[model samples]
Target: MNRTSFRGKGKRVEFPFREAFWMSLEQIRKRLKRSIILVGSIALGISLLTHLEMTNVILATYMSSMGSTMEAYQFWLIIVSLFVCGIGLINANLIAIYERYREIGTMKCLGAMDQHVMKLFLIESLIFGAVGGVLGFSFGTITAIASSSVQLGINALSFTPLEAILRYLAISTGLSVLLSVISTMYPALRAARLNPVEALRHNI
Candidate 1:
């Protein structure tokens, strides 16, 4: 919580990321049910994505004879899954903003600016996305390995490239965070643009 004061303009307060991070955690804790739903949604989407990618990699690595038809199908499936996930996130965040109208109003009255409100929501999403992504990736990777081992023998796991697995892990996690942030943009902006008086009067 560092504050920088402008000359002759009163205090221009800036919400530090550290404070925003803790505040976001507190909000999530208070809204446990909604938070869980959002996290689960993200995890389900990411898991499906990871499962497909890992399966494809395993199949391609162990069976190079596999044709492009499967890869094309997977590409479309992944796109559809991601699109659905993004829509869910946007809907959830909009509801969250509706429910938190009074809270946002109070913060604005207390000198919190639009960016502060936006940062809080984005940070919350980032946390949820990262957690969900890691969980999904782990589950997907394990499932992929187990099924592949059964079909292709234990040697399949041993021969799978560690570098590729690590790379996808990074990709999946980053993708989740990116998607969450992007999905929240509209909701956050709406929340930010709300008039304090109107927001305070919002019945939700």
Candidate 2:
């Protein structure tokens, strides 16, 4: 949605968000090689996160819904699962930060402001994170459902599978986007702070 705003002298100005968005997409495309791993890492991390979340929900549900005794090992399972997922998230984003220093420098040298540079990377991460979330949710839900169905009837997997799936999807999506943006902040800041000339000398 485009909104009219006054900058000065009562003149209307158009914010170029659509343009900036497209440029961000273009930049992501240009760096597809670098982006692939980041996206994959995010996807893997989100998948694990979603899986862990679902396990917690479903196990609790199973206990209440089916009246099963909870096992001691399950507690350790959840902790380990979350620990592994956290590691993946850290590793992937760190690698992306390491790889993009030159790109950041180039953007800085090209008259991009600090906020603009940060915005570009933040937007890119959000896009990647969203994609990763969807993929992760799909994989996590499918596996969870499949494994659950093998132990219990498909009908008993939940009160309603679709409702549960949608809920998990929403949860995973929110978490993935949040993590992506947070992970991106330091790198974005690093990029934004680079001296343009020094950056260009090394990166460009």
Best by lDDT: 1
Q: In order, what lDDT does every prediction score?
A: 0.83, 0.66
Model 1 is weakest, by summed lDDT over 10 consecutive residues, at 1-10
- Model 2 worst lDDT run, 10 consecutive residues: 1-10
| Tens digits of per-residue lDDT for model 1, 79-112 | 8998999999999999999999998888887788
Tens-place lDDT digits, model 2, residues 1-204: 122121323453332456667777886787787777767766776676566556555655666665333356755764565456556655665566556666656655544567776776788878987988898887876666666666566743673346667887988788777777877787777777878776656632
Candidate 2: the clashing residue pairs are none
**For this target, which candidate reaches the highest TM-score against the unseen true structure?**
1
TM-score of 1: 0.89
Query: What local lDDT score does residue 121 receive in model 1, on the 0 to 100 scale?
Result: 88
Q: Candidate 2: lDDT over CA atoms?
A: 0.66
